[model samples]
Target: MPDAHPHPEPSPAHPRPEPFLARTAPEALHDLRARLRATRWPDAPEDAGWSLGTDLAYLRELVTYWAEEFDWPAQEAALARLPRFRVPVGGLGIHYVHARAVAPTGPVLPLVLSHGWPDSFWRYSKVVPLLTDPGAHGADPADAFDVVVPDMPGYGYSDRPTGAPLDSIAVAGLWAELMDVLGYERFGAAGGDVGSHVSRYLALDHPDRVVAVHRTDAGVPRFFGDPAELAPEEHAWLEGGAAWGAAEGAYAAMHRTKPQTAAFGLTDSPAGLAAWIVEKLRSWSDCGGDIERSYTKDEILTNVTLYWLTETIGSSMRMYHANAAIAPAQLSRRVEVPSGFSIFPGDLVRPPRAWLHRVANAVRVTEPERGGHFAPFEEPELYARELRAFFRPYRAAAAS
Candidate 1:
């Protein structure tokens, strides 16, 4: 089996990416604790619960655990267990976790897992082993993948893009360069939320380079085809999405408009950062209003701390501004590559199959019984299964 895409001239050898270890300085950890301990309480209607925003009682409880109980060193060490590295790509030092699989026999496809907002590479932390060592987890050894999970700029250990903005389209181009740097002329792409959008663009912008793409949710454009002529079920899906937007889309608007204003408090106050990020983690998760049902306190704090320690809340929020600038034509571009979708029961928007077909050349679609927007983290086993089944067909094409 040979590579499907035209191979790049084996150019001047690429530099080895420097190994990276995720360790917050002791002083930074101490400062984070101080800020959490000193957080000022905010009042809310006694019975509003989460109707308003982040619940006051929940925030207080979460903050207290973050200040007194969370162990940053332990979490950092757990993260370090992955093979992480930082290399200069797209004019910035990019951090990523790379783990190659020694499969049983067949060709091993390289996989690039992209993560969404409110998360870094951590979202795929659970999925990496499943893809790279499926047999160890009781899955087929033939489904092994050489996994690469990059920390999107400003989201984690990656460099902040404060100098300029980047939309999903631009990130797609950058990803192609990163894949080439890693000696992968072609690779599979998969993601959820913002990551799903990035995967869509990667397939759209670099169809020849992307062998197949899997997404937990359909990256269907907002205005797909026309509203005047849609199937009854499609019409209902669109209206439900619209209703959800009117009710739950304010935060996206804020991220697009006044992220700087929100970033000040989030960057300055650890609690502020937790409240902003944790709200989404809870609301969007399948936890049914109780955040504890989905994520542990340490899991929540670890993600928020990544933003706090790096002081990248500003740049992360600015991604919304950048994406908002993507031209409508580009947004509506058809994804010509083989596409797969895993529709989780509790996902933010479960677009009908018809809607998905309108956007992508969808070859596989499944609705898992569990999970939500954070599918990879919430249901790693199911997420891995989705990828395995979706890409199984392309094995020969991808391998050769």
Candidate 2:
């Protein structure tokens, strides 16, 4: 192996750090509340609940909480306490939270976390502290991690892509550089949804730097041989995922093809934005058809409010279009790095161990009973434990 943290910052292509401070002006908050109050809702089907989409009755209740009860100032203040900063990566300023290890002398591991759509660094906020200070959280101090959570380009506070299309591979490259910017030579990668795709690429393309990889998904499964090659369970899991997509993946097709058109309504109408994101949050969560089972009014609204306040809905949609252009090499490349998988019972797709081993050198795998799409947000303690356990074998001083 060569020097992973091979050099200091001023990464040949980008120089100078651009720190970020997250804040929302009084005008923005007031405007959001006014829009919520002035919303003109659509009529619900006579007996419909969430069958058609986001339940109309539920949306109204959520909107009311968002407008009058939810507190943006308090949430903003809470987030500001995280060690947030910005730095140029590939000519764009990226916002990230870098929470250093808070453990006593032992192994020091740098772990970079990535988040998926309808969310950003907010997705990993709760788990960062626990991972950094496992001792305080009643976990092994030897399992502590120096965590870095970045807002993907065009998502959250990160600058949106411009001029050309930006896909997951590109984002992985940027994240690789970001670790270098923070002076970490060897690190581990973890994420879900789009972030899962990015993690796969990070390990595939930069295996030397990414010591190990962990993900909530194995990305889109690919099978070329006869169905007989797979076990009955594997075969069923593949077919099941495909069937689930056929039934519920319309939003993705629209995102890949007509995002710009959808953006017009989402970017302009707060209600439209809420409907677009809230539906996925409700459906994908393991809340057993009741959205409240997975998230509180404040929790749900806070994420929705971030998208509304930042006006990044359009750019976020554009990611689907960008990913559509992925080269075959990036898509088919094997993840040679040590990989781990945590299959949650309620997640939309939970492939068996055999399926995961086909994609990567899966070293560890577990099935936690709780959680859904947003594992870190839904079950922070469990999420942190999984990451700590998976990365324990690779923990050491930063690569040099």
List all candidate RMSDs to the true structure.
2.9, 3.3
Q: How does candidate 2 score on lDDT?
A: 0.85
Question: How many clashing pairs in candidate 2?
Answer: 1
lDDT of 2 by residue, 231-251 (tens): 887888889889888888889
TM-score of 2: 0.94
Error of 2 at 323 (Å): 1.1
lDDT of 1: 0.85
Q: Write the per-residue lDDT of candidate 1 for residues 1-400, one digit (tens) a residue.
A: 6643323332246666889987677899888888888888887887988989999888999899988999988988998999999988888888999887855457788889999998999899888899988999999988888888998887899998857678888887877888888888788999988899899999998888899999988653377466876778788887888888888888888988888888888899998889899999998888987888988999888888888888888888888888888888887777879999999988887899888887889888899988999988888998899899998877667666
Worst 10-residue lDDT window for candidate 2 reads 3-12
